[model samples]
Target: MTGTAFDLPLEVLRARQNVKWRKYAPDVLPAWVAEMDFSVAYPIRRAIERTVREQDYGYPQRNGQNAELLLAQAFADRMQDRFGWTADPALVQPLADLVQGTFAALWAFADANDGIILQIPAYPPFHSSIAETGRRLVPHRMHSDGSRHTLDTAALEGLVDARTRVILLCNPQNPTGRMFSRAELLEIGRIAIARDLVIVSDEIHADLVYDGRRHIPIASLSPEIAARTVTITSPTKSFNIPGLRCGVMHFGDAALLARFRARVPGHMLGAPGIIGIDATVAAWAESQPWLDRVLVQLHANRARLDAFLAIELPQVKWHQPEATYLGWLDCSALRLPGTAFDFFHNKARIAFSPGEAFDPACKDFVRINFATSTAILDQILDRMATAVRALG
Candidate 1:
């Protein structure tokens, strides 16, 4: 049970049966996707079954998402109790996914070709969302001092211009799995407020914090800071419900939320996928027991991976993440022949998002998802070790 509560196996998993049922030959460990391998919790399954039996896949009701939103609300209370970080559900709005909400929120405050500040080693989509909209992406690089990664605050301040209007941030960050503490977030929030900049915080992994680390929401740092923050949160990461397409865009600024609504007001809420919502709602409202179990096992898996790297693949360094399941493996020691992404894919047959995707300066680094069964992660590490050995 690995001290995670329910005593599930050290490498327990239940997933990708879809590939088998479809008659496809599988060679990949299938760790690329963010989805977890656990079975859908019982309440969610029951809800979806009832919905399907009633044939209720239809447009979102005009009354807003009070019934469905209740789960997130309850979950917030539960999280506050567990972690001491509280949020007001009144500030939260239902959305399709975090990226869409991020883009929509960015659209509300910035213009085409207007500068958007993004800290390096971020969620890759944050970079793309800015460029795809023709906005200038100003990268505020972070420094990796071998043992730990730290933000370059001076470099960030230097990049700001009158046109630089927004900063996109990831907490319990994607790829690197960093959960910024309250002091760190305060410094960041302080920067935004001083620059009169709006902040877009992608907090999908808020619930997946590991060990004793806490995820301090940038908005909740202070009243002034809160007024300038737009936090995108969901159970998609915690409960492995990304397929659900249900998320919340929390705004401390009513005027800002109104602006976002104006931008997407007439836009369709689209059809609600009953299964996804049920799973998401159940995860937030009633699946705390299951969540505790998952976190417990996750820590064991993380420890095992760390030990393996320390002994078997010392060329690539990794940290024990305080939150999230992604690992940023420092491959600078390997000095591979090409980019980290190409090197890993061509040599290892394992596809990880290249550092270039998140931060171009991080040319020697690669991001891997550790959110899989220990057995599969072991296979990946074995292949990874072999690939690194080939480089030597």
Candidate 2:
């Protein structure tokens, strides 16, 4: 873990967790999973180990003698500091994870029968969760001008109906790393308030932004907006601790909070998410120095990826990201004689989550993970380039 970027091993990564690792030879690089190759930071490991040693594996209590409770409050503070949004510990609800948090937000707006609004080319689970939950799937696709991504605010507003109760939003959006601007969030907040729709703001990637762009948590907008907003954040993505299965949900409205608090127990959510909370507290309260350095490395790796794709692999179209560590690549330029989805699957031997998984409009795109070292990214580019030329 304390080696040069090259010391980050593609073989070790490919060998460890990926299913493809056992099937393929050592030459291939793995970038499919969101999990990182780097070892968990010293502080985070210590926190989890301490929890383990203390026999803290029992079900967590919402507010009674629970470390999760303490950590939930810390996560709120961290969100406030990072996004200029204020929240209270008592108002924060810990879920099994962020995706679960989103579902819980959906439950909060049980009145939304027409379905919740999903921005396409989103995290694929949103679509599945919607169908599984029996809500209508209202697709509000993001418009890409070929260079940047913009939400069709008018289109989203049009999707809202009397039966629609909530809009689930991914900020510092997954797959495509575009961070929503303050202006964008304000417009969205205004629409949600006007339509009386609750906003499930999944800021899971809240901490991973580009150099200049700031993450605008929708809850921080104003009292009314915060009232209707359910803000979810965790150290899972930023700190590379997703296996812990911990995340936070914050609501400012007392009546809404009371309803949530009362129902959460019946829904089996009154239990605390101790691992998530402890790791989050350590991450927010102590891991800033490590995070700062990692950001620098990630930025460099991102730039390195962009330059390689632009020069060596010009046949691939990649939208340069303004935030997040993920790269959204448009592979249509390759024109490998079939749909972009199947091309990478069969020919490339590259296991990228297809563009179709994000949104219908992005059938020609692919979500590329660039959260690893420059060396690994270099290998990925090389493999993609070879796949393109060979398949063509």
TM-score of each: 0.87, 0.90
- lDDT (Cα, tens digit) per residue for candidate 2, span 174-271: 87787888888898899988988878888888888777677888888889988888888778778888777777788867777787656555255644
The TM-score that candidate 1 achieves is 0.87
Clashing residue pairs in candidate 1 are 1-7, 4-296
Give the per-residue lDDT digits (tens) of candidate 1, residues 1-392: 12322332323432334421123224444445566656656676676688789887674332366355564575467557755656677666767667878777777778998889887777878888898878888877666666657766667778889899898888877777767777778878888889999999888888888776667778777888878888888787787667767777778767766776787662544423556656667777777777777887788788988999999988888877778877888888887778887777777777666777778777788877776656666778888888888766
Clashes of 2: 4
Alpha carbon lDDT at 217, candidate 1 = 78
- Residue 390 lDDT (model 1): 77
Candidate 2 clashing pairs? 60-272, 115-136, 121-358, 121-359
At residue 154, candidate 2 shows an lDDT of 77
Give each model's whole-structure lDDT. Answer: 0.72, 0.74
